[model samples]
Target: MSIKNITVLGSGIMGHGIAQVSAMAGYKVVLRDIEQKFLDKAMEKVKWSLQKFAEKNKISKEEVDIFYNNITPLVDLQTAIGSADLIIEAVPEDFDLKKKVYQELNSLAEKNIIFASNTSTLPITELSKLTDRPDKFIGVHFFNPPQLMKLVEVIPGIGTDSKVTEEVTNYINKINKRPVICKKDVSGFIVNRVFIPMVHEALYSMERDNVSMEVIDSAVKYKLEFPMGIFELADYTGLDVVYKASYEMNLRDKAVLLLHPRIKQLYDSHDLGQKTGKGFYEYKGDNYERIDLTPEKASKYDPYSIIGVATNNASWLIDNEVCTIEDLNIALKLGMGLKMDIFDFFKKNGPDNIMNKLLELESKYGSFYHPNQYLYSIK
Candidate 1:
């Protein structure tokens, strides 16, 4: 089905950006929120973002006006989604709240309208069960800043129609974004599955090896060539978000994913990273100035220890047929903003060396670090 009219529910950070992008792609977008004030705020943000794009020469001033004008904000759900051909839900990450929204939409929306969730952690398959049109329901996991982030993870639930998946992927491309198809609707999908585990390992390294966060952050930034250190990224992403994502993934796969104690403590204390000015580190000023990580400190910890865990998790995704190696590599590079392919370590170090590293990590970190069968097969 060709989607011409899009309805973006929630009109918050992700929702507003999704609406703006869809409008930029020449789709009529209805941005909906429960309150008029939220709709007003969302429109202001959308205008500001579009103006920035214009100032940066990314888009013409007239194009910004056109894009900004293309979005219609509304508070009433029935009026907002009445003419929508596709609905993308970007509500807060509450399971019950999302289910409630779907229940309401199921009754109000036409059966033919495709429903997509911007959920970062919850399984698409489980969410599809909440609606009558499971075949039309899919997950379009957009990164935090939808306006800037290029990668979009297209996840089709087990019962989702292949045709629907293709249509959504094509729609994503039309908006000038990269779409990596995730074959299975597992918790955390591709990027987070690989990322969260790597962060957990970093925390474990700090706790077990007694290494400082600065050393770990320095090693990750300089050694791994990541734009930001693991802790830095976590803080930037908000510790509450990280903690909740870890909690959700753990609930689904407790054996392999565990929430680290430090994450929980920071979250409980409400020191949620850059937004709150404190998390793994402290942030000061309105712009949230970056924490300086010294390059010399990179030598203190071996980054391969963390890379080994990421490699094992990526291998697990491949072995389980969750996503192709090509897609996984693209997802990491685009979604997680990795400077290199996730399996570059496995390829450079060879499977045997990686296995030995995993074995060593497993002995120190428990069964979670144990290598998947794919690594052995390659060996």
Candidate 2:
């Protein structure tokens, strides 16, 4: 069955965006929060975003009214979810809080209604277990700013039915988003599985090599042609968000991937990137001026070392059957907006060179930098 009505739980950053996208796609969407103030703020943001779209001709001026009308804001949970064909929970990333929400949703929601969480790094299997309908529960992780980001990671828990997976994938497509299936539910899924470690390695490089944040950011942005440097994106995404995601993933792997202490220091100080007006680099409003860091200083730290560690982690994911090579690439390209073929770089650099660099990093950082079996098999 097609999803006609979608209920977006929570009216925070992700929730509001998800609701807007669903409404824009012509689905009747209920944007629910616990408080009227939060609902009002979400609505205001949606209106401003819709107006921006209209000015850009992304949506017609007349269409703005149609889209806005499609979204209904409510504080009452039962009233909001009563007719929902699908409910996407965009709540805060707290285990107890999510479990409690699902427990209550189990009683309030219809038996057949599909439940999806927009969790970044949490296990779908664990979240599914909290509800009565494990087979119907799945993860529909939309990248930040769901209205613009094209990719959605559709993940199925161990108990999730294949049909439920197919339905959720179809619904994501209907909303004009590309769906990359995470065949197995693992912490960090696919995009963050590869992306987060890369950023963490960047931080480690800065710490070990004694390079400035600007040096690392400039090299990654200029040399690698990424849209934003590591620190720049971290600030844009909020250091606290990244730290929390890393901390959650660390819980499963005995802390193999640890956030740099500098990141934790920034997070603790509430200097959370663009949101808080400061992070790794200072920002003037939404604009961050590049400080003209020297590429010579950046060259002191090998870019390939960081790239190899991320690639090895990607290979590890492949080795474990978390996702196929094709799925992982698509998730990174579409979800993280890498916009380049990750595997092609391996072909260009050659496995021996990549492996050698990884080995060098491994000597300094231990097994976390060690190449996975897939890297070994790559000849």
Candidate 3:
């Protein structure tokens, strides 16, 4: 099915970005929120972002106005979704709230209107069950700031129609973004499943080895060639988001995906990273300033310990058929902004070296670090 008119159901951070990118892609976008003030604020941010694109010469000033004008901000849900061919739900991550929204959408939207969610960690299968048309529902997991992020994970529920998945994949491509298919509707999908454990290991190392956040961040940034250190990225992503994702993943796999105490502490205190001016590191204000991680500090921590955990999770995903090695590599490189795939590092460091690190981590951190069958086979 062809999707022309798109209705975005929220006006929050992810919602607005989704709308912005949709508009930029020349789709007629209705950006809807419950409150008029919220809609107004979202539109202003969209305008500001469009202006930035013009300033960067990515788009002409005329094109900025044209794209910005493509989006129509509205408070009426029925009116916003009335002419939509696709309804992308960017609402808050609360399951109950999303269920209610889908119920309302079900009652109001046309029968053929495809439904999509921009959920980061929630299972697409469970969410699809809430809608009348499970075959029409899918997960389009966009990273933070959808307009800027190139990676969009296309996840299909068990009940989701394959044709629907293909159409959405094509739509994502039309928006000038990289689309990676997550074959199974697993918790954390592909990117978070493999990456979150790496973040957890970083936190664990800090607590266990007395490694400073700066040292860990430095090692990840300099040694691993990631754009940001794991701690810095956590702070930038907001500790609450990171904690909630970890919490959700843990709920599904309690033994393996346990939450880190440091993350929980930050979340409990509401020091939610850059948004709150503090998390693992302090930010000056609402503006995000990258933490200065000195390369000299990289020597204090072995970045391979973190990579070992990530490689294990990647192996688990591959073994379970959640995604292919090629897709996982693309997802991590694009979604996490890594210089190279985790598997590349795994191969470079060699299976024996990575296995030894995993064994060491397993001894220190319980069975979660235990290498999987794939790792053993390689060894």
State the lDDT of candidate 1 residue by residue for 1-379, as single tens digits: 8899999999889999999999999999999999999999999999999999999999999998899989999999999999998999999999999999999998899989999999999999999999999999999999979999999999999999999999999999999999999998887899999888777778887877799999999988887778899999888888888888899999998754646788889989999999998888888887967777888898877666677787888888999899988999899988777878766656654566667877987787689878888877766
Best by lDDT: 1
Candidate 3, 1-379: lDDT as tens digits:
8989999999999999999998999999999999999999999999999999999999999999899999999998999999998899999888899999998988888889999999998889899988999999999999998989999999999999999999999999999999999998887899899777778889877877788889999988887788999988888888888888898888877654656788788899999988888888878856779887988898767776787888888888899998988999899998888889777777765677768877886887689878889877655
Q: How high is each candidate's TM-score? A: 0.96, 0.94, 0.96
Q: Write the per-residue lDDT of candidate 2 for residues 1-379, one digit (tens) a residue.
A: 6689999999998999999999989999999999999999999999999999999999999999999999999999999999999999999999999999999998899898999999998999999999999999999999888888999999999999899999889988988999988888877888888777777878877877778778787777665656777778777778878888888888886434646677678878999888788887777756656556666745655467666766777787888888878888888787666657676656555667778877887787677777788877764
Worst 10 residues of 3 by lDDT: 252-261
C-alpha RMSD of candidate 1: 1.5
Give the alpha-carbon lDDT of every model.
0.88, 0.83, 0.87
Candidate 2 residue 228 C-alpha distance from true site, Å: 2.0
TM-score for candidate 2: 0.94
Model 3: residues with Cα > 4 Å off, grouped in runs: 377-379
- Once fitted onto the true fold, the runs of candidate 2 whose alpha carbons sit more than 4 angstroms away are 288-300, 349-351
In what order do the candidates fall by lDDT, top score first?
1, 3, 2
The TM-score measured for candidate 1 stands at 0.96
